[model samples]
Target: MTDVTLMDFHADWCGPCKTQDPIIEEIEEDYDEVTFEYVDVDEEPDIANEYQVRSIPTIIVKNEEGVVERFVGVTQRDTIEDALSQAGN
Candidate 1:
């Protein structure tokens, strides 16, 4: 099986990031096969820069092959779930 990871990039001060957090949390509960990582841009600038994340609430779904999908801003739960399903497959 492939190793799938969901990276959430955001800062504590970002409002949109707050909005996106719960959706990610829900996805975390549903997708046990996917690894979830939360990166605080303020604390982990290098990681954010490595991912080229220019905005808050950036959701990146990637597998061992590499990044499969990237969503900027507030993303819908279904959209993220779909991306995970595809990437996992």
Candidate 2:
């Protein structure tokens, strides 16, 4: 299994999520060491509920040890990279 995983929770109809998707995709392309995954809230409500996601564009970064960081809404690239660095990605 990958050491670090970035979970992006979003829905197709969400405007903010649409904006966030490309940013996440860009991060995925830039970070080969970090695993990136997308969860469509509309299709996977269970996963959203498990993560306690109350809004769209929720991002969860975790490693094998456990969760490193989590944020909601639009996030800065440097901030995400910092979390990945801390998580040993």
Candidate 3:
């Protein structure tokens, strides 16, 4: 079971991912129940392959049973909140 997992695929050289870090950190702060995992594409190639990540700053929100619901680029606070809220329900 997933039990609310948010995986962020990123790279150290990615400017967009750096720009999006604060927003994600804020989301992590807001959603205490949600578990966040950060995978560096450069270091964790296996994970990137498992997730089929093609770009940096990819956010994958998975529910229980490891089913992915949201898979996209950098996400905003409201968007993440809404997604989490829906996942909770």
TM accuracy, model 2: 0.92
lDDT of 1 at 53: 95
Worst 10-residue lDDT window for candidate 1 reads: 25-34
Give every collision pair in model 1: none
- Per-residue lDDT for 45 in model 2? 94
On the 0 to 100 scale, the lDDT of residue 79 in model 3 is 81
Per-candidate Cα lDDT values, in order, are 0.93, 0.88, 0.80
Candidate 2: tens digits of C-alpha lDDT, residues 1-89: 34899999998889998888878888999989888888998999999999899898999999988888999999888888888888884
Order of the predicted models by TM-score, top scorer first: 1, 2, 3
Q: Which residue pairs in candidate 3 collide?
A: 2-65
Q: 1-89, model 1: which lDDT tens digit per residue?
A: 57899999999899999899998998899878889999999999999999999988899999989999999999999899889889988
Which one wins on lDDT? Answer: 1
What's the TM-score of every candidate structure? 0.96, 0.92, 0.87
Stronger candidate by lDDT (1 vs 2): 1
Model 2 C-alpha lDDT versus the unseen true structure: 0.88
Which is superior by lDDT, 1 or 3?
1
